[model samples]
Target: MLQHLIDQDEGLRMVPTDRNELTTAVGQLNEELRGLPEEADPARTRVLTRWIGIGQMCLGNHDEARTVLRQSLDLAAALGNTRAVVATGLNLGDAHRYAGDVQGADALYRSALNTARSHHPELVDFALQHTGKNLMERGDLASAKAHLQEALRLRITKGDAGLVESTQAALARVELLIGRADASAADGAVPRQWSGEWTSWLQSRTTAQTPARWAEDFPALRDAVRGLNAHQRVYPRHLRDQPFPAELIAAMAAEAEKAVAADGYLHNGKWNAPVGDAASRFAGQVDLAAVVARSTGLEVEQPHTAVYIAYLEEGQFLDFHVDEFGFGEANLILCLQHERPTAAPSVSTTVFITADGCLECDLAAGDCVVFDGALTPHGRTPLTAGESITLISLGFRARDQASRTVTNLPPVPR
Candidate 1:
């Protein structure tokens, strides 16, 4: 009854930004904690303590959150609740991260990861995801991407749409920073003559109203729709995967290293340095726009002036975000180089938010993943410790934009 009252009073949500709500939630949580059986039930006390700490966090009281979460962690540890331990660790890590202690946050996340890995592998993704997010904030893009990718791969395997969407958004943000795709649209500016099918599709999906398949001929699309009907929204569909010859991959990697070395990286944001010409030498021969159009059923022509390439060493990652629809209708990504033939290799993965589900697909050195940039949400995971990723992105204007011409303003320097 007390718990129900607390939930009702607090709206079963996070601490509200409104001063009255915050105070009320905190006070109610405190009252509940006081009433919890102290010595008779350690487990219950730990859970309530954790909730209070989370409430404190929602109110931006990191110091109080840390104290309370630490105590909860201790109790959970004593009770042998490994999952709770992991959860508490994550909460505490967030408190530290928000308090501007990156190292402390990393340590806590790593500790949680280790604990999860040993006793509860299913919980490893949580630790990795939080760590990746922290790394992104600390300017450690490579590590951030790597961790985020690991977490995303796990979430994909688990078929969790909500987690997958959130992670994809993080990865996408990282890519935009590196690719400088937002150069044309800064300051949250929307295009004057822009219309995206995503919003309408999102609305339809919300009401469980299935729409016509853009690519009815593709089994992947059909299967995705079937899964959507079954309430599964994290489907994996690979339109194509053809392995490039080892020699070709080597040559491409060599050119990429040289070009990035010569041109340097353009930093428009936090995580990535944009390389507009990662594979200019092979641009004419390899146009995957047609493949994208066929698979996604969107007319994407008029390739952007230059392909955006990102050269990421270990520890770098892209955050999740949707592509700028105003700049291009769709995005065609080609993985130029990835993974080493060593004993233990790390593969790079891309997470996508489809109309009905989430797609987490791994990319090899020669593979390509194409989707509607404006409509679907997507992002890439970080590279392995010793491995690096050199990939190129080609954006295509919508078919409707062919007849209409406007002076495209370049992205501003941040």
Candidate 2:
């Protein structure tokens, strides 16, 4: 009788004549799931749990959705139901991501991708979509684009209209971001040789190299990370009596100033002027990128994707947010200049609100700060009047190994 009632309710709610009626039908479905016998088959129970979890997610009850989906995933895995496991895992990953657990979502999606590859090759596209979406949200645009592009190709081969449409939309957005970054860059700011598909250039460097090899290739970078704080590291002009090349710094600053003019001031409560490709000339001319990579233990041979400048004027400040890109994880921030020089020289102070209380530092001109901006939330308090700061950012994907679990999954069977 209860099953019949749920079926009847679902039929009525299919079109959802009204919000209240649809919600009531969902409540009926929930009650039916709850009324199932304690001795019910685990697989059957998991099916119900998965449905309930998906419904909860659609209803915007993310916390309940995750709880329900986790139960489904656990039961499905124990039963060795590869199909159910992949389904529940993907749903649960989305739930966790919606709840702001990005790291957890990435892990879950990676595991799902692994399971799908080994047991259900047909589900590879589904798993890739979820993984790519999570990375995109986390600001790993380069990785996100790769995953989405692959998923789109698979979906095309499968001839799935719905999947193709959605994946294309995602791929387009990634392209748009790349396009914006390119358009915003100063003309002649980057050489034509450096102008090819930026993400593809990055992927080309994903050779099978161990961290030890990276350490050997870039010893200075390894040393820098070793002395890093939990969330950040500072590299003083170790050359002592010598600071960064003023000529190089000046060239970067000029490009940044021009970019700001072209792009206009970006304001989201706080004003910021992003100078695209501002540091390209310097990074391209000298071994600055190698030094930056070495400083962060990244591969010395791999090129950084983006190098830009940020002009933060007085009273303007950046809010706390983690980097969404892989390159953002090991960001190289160099202070170019600051107005209203103090006795100690004006600086843009950063406050890293970490799990271990707060760590504050004054990032002064000519000094470089290398830190995993993705793992922690760091921001600046508003600068005082007549105070301004220019910072050059070198963003590279040095931690490609973290993605191997998903990307290196066995290829889908023909």
Alpha carbon lDDT of residue 134, candidate 1? 78
Best by lDDT: 1
Candidate 2 per-residue C-alpha lDDT over 1-414 given as tens digits, one digit per residue, 9 for 90 to 100: 112222212211112234455456567767878888989888777887887776666555667878999999999989988898898899898877765555568789999999999999899998988888788766688998999989999999999998898788777777776776667454324322222222222223221112123223333322322322332332222211124678877766676666556654564333344443335445545675466565655653334554444545655666544444334445666767666545534444654533333445666656666666544445565676677667666665543445422122221111
Ten contiguous residues with the weakest lDDT in model 1: 4-13
Q: lDDT per residue, candidate 1, 1-414, as tens digits?
A: 122222211111223446566667668878878876646688877887888887777666767888999999999989888899998999888877765455567789989999999999998888887877777766677787888888899999999998888678777655655455356445335433222232333333332111123234234433433422232111234645553355555566665566566654654221232332224335434555566566666666746534436636654555334344444656667677765538545454676555455566777677777665443445555555676666666677766554321223222111
Q: Which ten residues in a row have the lowest lDDT in candidate 2?
A: 5-14
Looking at model 2, the pairs that clash are: 138-324, 139-324, 139-325, 140-324, 221-294, 221-295, 327-396
lDDT comparing candidate 2 with the true structure: 0.59
Off by over 4 Å in 2: 1-22, 181-414
How close is every model to the real structure, measured as TM-score? 0.41, 0.43
lDDT of 1 at 51: 81
